[model samples]
Target: MLKKTDCCQGVVNRKDKDGNTALHRAAAKNYPQMLKLLLACKADKNVTNQAGLTALDVARGQVNNRESINILGVCSFAGVSTLYKLWQLIVKILTEASTEIFQDMDGISSDDRNALLVILGLLLTATYQAILSPPGGVWQGAVFIVAFFLTLGLLKPFPRGFKTALQVLLAFFAICFQASIYPIIPFYFYVPLVINIFIFLVFVIMMSMCTASRVSKISVMVLGCWLLVGVIYQSFASFGS
Candidate 1:
């Protein structure tokens, strides 16, 4: 009906009594085809509903039909998923190198280990919250997911005495993983994601090699610092664009 000149020009962009436009209803109803048609007819997607949610916001809140979210293309779900897999691989590498890369297990006293465990727990909590309700949204959640998994991986090398703590952390990590996968994201977010993943993998490998006595530890540390700085610069640049 949107093809009809009167409908297209008159009420296609009209909001209901609740302030939801045709585009908002299309998104909320998970009708991607209808959404495309309405958008083609120049329906206003940015119109806020009674709750101040745009069509894109409504799409993100949809639990089952994510194609609607994908059609909207505001969140970075694709980039975040790719980063999630990449971080899993990085965690596996870190796990294998834990013995050599982490501080010697024997050197950490009970008090120190407990303190480290507490710190990791706090970091996990913060990352989980950040990912679920990100500040900058989109790519910000992607960054927090990286930090979440990295911290979780770091928690793996602790003594068996902390097995209970490890289990609790894993449970929350799984929840965070679930929350991060819901958004349907755009393609450009990959710029920052790829940069972060490449740098992290390099950082891990360099740490392992240096600890294996294959390279100068100080040299690896310096290189890691510089690479981290470069990644930060590139990530911000790409994300802003």
Candidate 2:
């Protein structure tokens, strides 16, 4: 019924009681309508009052916070469900986008891809056995978290083809991660969960190598080389022994 903009502007331009403007009142009352109007009228939303609070800042001080609370209710925070959904979507998109084998950053095509694939597959294979045997809920949750983080690490700016292979691995891992967390409470229900988690991590590493968008790629590469050297050295040592 009231035009808050004009009213707020009138106070902003000057001459108000107690040196407080309409913006002050709007903030105190948590009056979104009035505040918006005042802001549109050049009411200096950033201007602080004698108490050092801006319109938005003052709005936050309203203790009962009836209006602000209502506003917040309309905006939900991102949660595990949201992340999982996004992860699934990313996996699907990647799967649809690529058809090529991912080459390493170097001239080398992934000699490591095979090893990672084997590790991941075996982990998944072991997971089902664990799950049916006992409730290992905590283990399952832990596995899921590890898989999820690994997935994040895997997502890269690499071309679509390479991404797709990684995505297949991503989806597989995500499924396993979620699977482990199933029957959610009482922490004793996820013996199979750990296996799934292991599957996810193994492949995620493979994916990370192929999709090294991060600055840390050099370090990872160096570490991989060192491991390779260590393996060769160990083999030679065993032969000599």
Candidate 3:
């Protein structure tokens, strides 16, 4: 048992009389699930048995053990290959964009940097004015400001595990923002604002999953669909009113 402090230290890679580790046994027997679990627990796949066979070597000797082979490290998410690859590609593109957006001035010429800064400053001023005089209502303007804050937070660089802190900060902001909306805005306005906040929360979670080791692509896709529906419904409600 990994939870037992006395044994967990070397238990995962503990070898038997033949010098075969749990990883070797799982691979030789073609137990994909067991192999995946052992790997996830940090099993040493390169550990060789008395016969000089690694887990991968043993897996190769077996018949039709592609799943086990993949579990050993070939395609990381063999079960969800297509969607996983798509998401990985999307993350790569976004990571490159983040690099450009957050890059230091050392790589850019002075004039180029100044020009970019001016453009951003102008956009910020225009955005502020739009929020101040939003067509929908003051509630919509408040939601816009919160959304902008969340977007900037997501784009900025943070150290490992800092995203969780950002999520907490955003949750606190959302709660305070919602509380402030109750008295001044009508019930109809409050509904769309709540939907917008929910959408923002979902967006943050989806982005967080891009860097997380453990992910649920199906759940993320479903949340994306739900947010789309919410946005559509809010649009209709706004136009009909």
Candidate 4:
């Protein structure tokens, strides 16, 4: 849609039979980078679909990511088997971390901070190198899982501004790391990158929403700044090259 027509006009004119624009679809599909891009192109945020659903409505549906997964008639492994496996592992990590966050002190007494720190350290190293090196998606996936745990570690009882600081660090590094990977990944796979990055944004936002700390809010803003700058700079640099 963005390719055939100017982004602004396409978003303006393209609506479902139900009167939803690309923005509606993007939000429904949990595509924040797409949402940001559409908004940048002046998409009408106020526009309601035929069902009277706003972008926020669609985003809200994604709040419970694992819960809303439709197992019925959903072929889990017929296609993209490796990615499906990866998805399962990612979900497991997210779910476990989420559970740990709410668990009691006595329950968390079993939580190994050293193990967590080691995993987080390893993930940062692994993800940074994985993109620049040969195909090591397994390692990359491990990094993602460890990072999810790291986020959980920061979430519970966050002090004045720790959660926010961690998110900014994660978002900044993730953006930079992914930007580097973009050049290596075939342009055809750009959609996956877009979709996952959108999910990343959603995860970051969720972390912000769940936390009462002010730093989390600040972190979101700073991460947004980095994403915006990264996108613009990447586009210009890539185009010039």
Every candidate's CA RMSD? 21.8, 19.5, 11.8, 17.2
lDDT, candidate 3, 56-173, per-residue tens: 8789899999998887765333335346447657766755654454345335565665565455445544544444353524435444444444343342233334544544444444
Clashes of 4: 0
Clash number by candidate, in order: 1, 10, 0, 0
Q: How far is candidate 2 from the true structure (C-alpha RMSD, Å)?
A: 19.5
Q: What would the per-residue lDDT of candidate 2 be over residues 185-222, giving only the tens digit for each residue? A: 33332433343344445444543443333213333344
lDDT of 4 by residue, 1-241 (tens): 5433223443463677888888777767766566667765666555557776555555556765332233111332233434544754664565465456444522343356545556677777766777677654433644564575455454444443565566667666665665665566444445445635654665554444333222344555655666666666655655555
Per-residue lDDT value at 108 in model 3: 59
Estimate, for each residue in 40-113, the C-alpha lDDT of model 1 and write its tens digit: 78675655678877788888888886888877775433345346457546645654675454446446677776
Rank by lDDT, descending? 1, 3, 4, 2
Give Cα-based local distance difference scores for all models: 0.58, 0.47, 0.57, 0.54
Candidate whose TM-score is highest? 4
For lDDT, candidate 2 versus 3, the one ahead is 3
Q: Which is the winner by lDDT between candidate 1 and candidate 2?
A: 1
Query: Residue 64 in model 3: shift from native, Å?
Result: 8.0
- The numbered model that scores best in lDDT is 1
Cα error, candidate 3, residue 90 (Å):
1.3
The local distance difference test score of model 2 is 0.47
